[model samples]
Target: MERFIETLMYRSRWLLAPIYLGLSLAVLALGIMFFRELFHLIVEIPTIAEANMVLMVLSLIDLAMVGGLLVMVMMSGYENFVSQLDIAEDEEKLNWLGKMDSSSLKAKIAASIVAISSIHLLKVFMGVKNYDDMQLMWYVLIHMTFVASAFAMGYLDKITKH
Candidate 1:
């Protein structure tokens, strides 16, 4: 019975496979939204003010960063938690695909979150009139918190590795 239970527990890792596939679907949705935003930007380019154009471009960048984060998380989480992906040697492959372990993936995620937050904060600053002073303060505070957390995590990870 003990041996059977161990086998069951080990095989349960497959349960996460579906969840990772869901993340791919999310990436697809993000792609659709990105193209939708791009279409809007292109359509409005002639009449759009320079500030508004900048804000729109920033928004697109934010979406792209988010999409990249999602892909990274999905692929790395799958590889770390589930079975290794089988890829042909002749096909195009991501350089970091099989190389990222969970620790490195976490660090990358933290850094990506900070970057995404920075872009968001920039967008908010570009349209400062839309937000009050309190909101602006909260945005900066929240972004700072992300920065601090990522830094602390990296520091701890480094110390732990030594």
Candidate 2:
């Protein structure tokens, strides 16, 4: 019975394999969404509608940034936690893959969030005529909160690593 249990534990490491692969599938879904957004933007280009075009452009940028963030996290997290990706010697490889451990990954994620937030804030500012001053202030505050939280998290993580 003990040997059987040991075998189970040994094989369970591979169970993580599937979970990591699922992350790739999620990445695929994000790609689909990204392209859909892109096509929508293209379709709307000729309408010359009253909608805030600048804000809409910022929104598209924000979505692309988010897609990038998802790809980084999904691929890097899988590589860090599950297995090293076997990129062939002659093939192009991700420069930062395997190099970014969880700590670095957190920092990258934080920075990405800040970038995405900045885009969102810009969108809000561009649409300022439609939004009240209070709503704009809240948007700015929420983004600042996210910035502060990310800073604190990176600092604490750094302290622990040493």
Candidate 3:
């Protein structure tokens, strides 16, 4: 009975497989949105102001960053928690595929979030006339919070490693 229970517990890690698959589906959805934005930018180029177009391009960059974050999380999370990925010897492999552990994954996620937040803050600043003073202050505060959190995480990880 003890052996059976251990086997069952070990195999249960497969439960995470579906969640990783779901992230892939989300990537597909984001790709569709990205192309839609690209098409809109091309069609509206003549009518839109230069600043507005820049903001639109920034949105595309934000989406790409998010998609990258998702892929990293899904792949790394699966490898860390579920099981090692089996790949063909002849297939091209990603350099970072099996290297990122949980701690590194967390750091990458934090950095990505800070980057996305910076882009968002820039867009808000570019259109400052649309936001009141309070709104602008809140945006800056929120971005600062992300920066502080990421810094603390890095510091803690460094000290722990030593």
Task: Specify the highest-TM-score model's number.
Answer: 1
Task: List, residue by residue over 57-106, the lDDT tens digit for candidate 3.
Answer: 99999999999999999989899989888889999887888999998999
What's the candidate order when arranged by decreasing lDDT? 3, 1, 2
Clash pairs, candidate 3, are: none
Candidate 2 lDDT over 66-118, as tens digits, reads 87887788778877866788999999988998798888989989999999998
Encode model 1's per-residue lDDT on 28-139: one tens digit a residue: 9999999999999999999999999999999899999999999999988988999888889999889999999998998999999999999999999998999999999999
Candidate 2 displacement at residue 128 in angstroms: 2.0
Query: How well does candidate 3 match the true structure in TM-score terms?
Result: 0.95
Q: Which model is ahead, 1 or 2, in terms of TM-score? A: 1
- Scanning candidate 2 in windows of ten residues, the lowest lDDT window is 48-57
Per-model TM-score on C-alpha atoms: 0.98, 0.79, 0.95
